[model samples]
Target chain A: MLSSSKVKLIQSLNKKKYRQKYNLFVVEGIKNIKEFVFSNFLISNIYTTEPIPFMQEHQYQIISHEELKKISFLKTPHNALALVELPDTLPYSIQGIQIALDSIQDPGNLGTIIRLADWYGIEQIFCSETSVDVYNPKVVQATMGSLARVQVNYTDLKKLLTTSPIPVCTTDMDGENIYTSCLPQEAFLVMGNEGNGISEDIKSISNLKLTIPRFGKKQKTESLNVAISTGIILSEFFSQKEKI
Target chain B: MLSSSKVKLIQSLNKKKYRQKYNLFVVEGIKNIKEFVFSNFLISNIYTTEPIPFMQEHQYQIISHEELKKISFLKTPHNALALVELPDTLPYSIQGIQIALDSIQDPGNLGTIIRLADWYGIEQIFCSETSVDVYNPKVVQATMGSLARVQVNYTDLKKLLTTSPIPVCTTDMDGENIYTSCLPQEAFLVMGNEGNGISEDIKSISNLKLTIPRFGKKQKTESLNVAISTGIILSEFFSQKEKI
Candidate 1:
């Protein structure tokens, strides 16, 4: 049986402040929990309706479905849910073609970007302080087990871009066509907010500005979704490198 | 002034059965409603909190915000909402690079695909009976404005593939790499369901099988999101054709 306070604490982790205060976030669904279990992330608690063989004897408590429902954040709660310790944010390290985000606010978009980063072999993602929390449950669920693979660091994006050693690449309306641009093997590709493209400050500092040309007959779409833009751009970079 | 029966009709339009019965669907938010107004779609009614300059004087009824909230589907209702006539499904015509969805269950995915097809200049989409309705409010909202440009038809997959004049291209784990493959200018590109990709029946008939190669070091990711995958594949096709 889940205690009222325990249920409250688990539910509170859905918000960023509480997640940071406790340094804990929830991971639900059997597939996602299994990925976290097998990865380096340390699991603090596990609540489930059935036995999870991989979890330690004392790690997970098999609770009734009624008890599980009380603590689950999902509308239709999966078989299991886990409380995981958030990893300490490591110092920013220069890497091959790192993705930089300037206030990407959507958790779903951030999660899809993280999964795309994992697929294309990009190891690190640098996010502005304003970006949505990577530990947000929506992001964790959207990653589809890739949250265990890709590392995301939240930092002051302007400072990072100013000091970066590699060329800063960003997408824009009138920028160089990505198909024709000589994309570097190692660069920082920056994406921006949903409503706005890359902020002017970031765009000014970006050494290479790329654009995905629109082909529609009427050409009315204002912009692509941040995550979809990331996927198409990464495909170009990866295809150019013959990496994927 | 809004009548109780009118509000009831608008609310009922949320369901597929009611939408089919009335041949109408709701278009909310100023941007999407404007797109429908500018397009060939016939508008049945417009309800708004204030006057819309572009709408005909008699077309929109200025209503109170409280009344607007009563009929709006959005969490925060936008400036306006319109009931639009659903276009009759025209007979499927052979087109340049048509998109075929086996059973894309997510409304958001279908919406994004419609928007992406607009961006790439692909005009027609064919979906199986199991696919979500294009008129789904979430989809209509997600499409932004591209719903005006693309056409979607529900048809039998097995029959469509058998009768297609061009090759049917679909992605798989062990297929030819999309980056190096010669993508045809005019073909039916099939993307599948979210969890279980292109059903076996469709897979057996795919003439050209392509794969988006994974380049991650550990490669733990099972697959890309259907929408993201569609973006990457469409990018390759568009780039190869120089359609932009």
Candidate 2:
């Protein structure tokens, strides 16, 4: 059972203002809750329809499915919902090949990119301020369990790139082909918005502009999706490093 | 204003039975509708808030925004909606590079792959019958009018792969590294279910099983997303072809 205040607080996290004020974000679905519970991440609270044996170590409440559903953002609520404490703000540190997304507006894209970045062992992702809110229910759901492992920082992309010493790369159609391009091992790979590519100011700061070559005879579609391109780029980076 | 009967009929397209019975599907959004209207697709009807200067050449109705929203499947209704005649069943032709999705459940992934396939000039996509219905309103919206261009067929993947002469290549964790794998210019690339990899029977038919090499120093995420994997594989196919 949940107190009225608890339920209100859980519901409040849906908005960015509440999330920021409370320094907390929502993570839902049985898999995600399990992942967060078992991970090193700190969970402020857990709400579920039934006893989640896996999350026994956390502060939790077994509420009715109807009650859980009320606070769930999904159309079909996953078995569990959790409030995770947002990490204290950390200064940007240019390390291994980190992925920086400039104004990626889609929640699903940002989440999937976080998952993809996690798989490649890239621990940090920086999203432009205009990017979809990471704590948006849709983004949290899309990240699956990867959100537990990846550190996502929302910052002004233009500022970050301009002052960076490491080479910055932006994906574009007219850029040098990615296949033959010499991508540095430790640098920032900037991805652009869904409808628009990288902005001019950001593009100017990009030390290199790369493209994934299209081999098919047809040019029916304008561009490869930003999320899709990230996968191909990450795949090539890993494959290249292994050979060396 | 849309007639009540017409509105009910459009909403019915949400179900599989209604879709097959009417032999029609819906496409929405400003960009999608504009592209869909201009593309070679047959527009059975169009519902809009205002007269589209160019679309005046076609059959359309200027309806209230509320009326347009009534039949819209999206959270935010576009300015227009179009009922398109489902193309005739295509003759299943086996040749060149192909993509097969097994039990994919996400509409967004289904749509993005359709767009990616069109960009790569891949002619056909085969999906396991259990996959999301290609004509689902969400899927149609996400395809960005590429649905009209690509030929999608849903069938039993196990039976199809077993009988087909084309080499079946699948993605797996412990498989050959894709960068060095000599991929056939013409073959069926099998992408598996959202949560599960290729089934045993499908794996049995695979001529090659390869993995996308990960560059991240730490493998933190559970798995690379299926759609992301599909993009990486398609890009590699094009890259290999370009080198040749």
Residue A87 local lDDT, model 1: 87
Q: Write the per-residue lDDT of candidate 1 for residues B54-103, one digit (tens) a residue.
A: 76678888889998899998999998889999997666578788899999
Fraction of native contacts, model 2? 0.67
- In candidate 1, how many clashes are counted? 0
DockQ of 2: 0.59
Chain A vs. native, model 2, TM-score: 0.93
lDDT of 1 by residue, A12-77 (tens): 998999998999998997788888888888889988888787766677888888888887877888
Instruction: Name the weakest run of 10 consecutive residues (lDDT summed) in model 1 chain B.
Output: B235-244
What class would a CAPRI assessor give candidate 2's docking?
A: medium
State residue A113's C-alpha deviation in candidate 2, in Å: 0.8
Task: Show model 2 residue runs off by greater than 4 Å.
Answer: A38-40, A54-59, A216-218, B37-40, B55-58, B214-220
Q: Model 1, retained fraction of real contacts?
A: 0.68
Using DockQ, give the best candidate's number: 1
lDDT of model 1 at position B140: 90
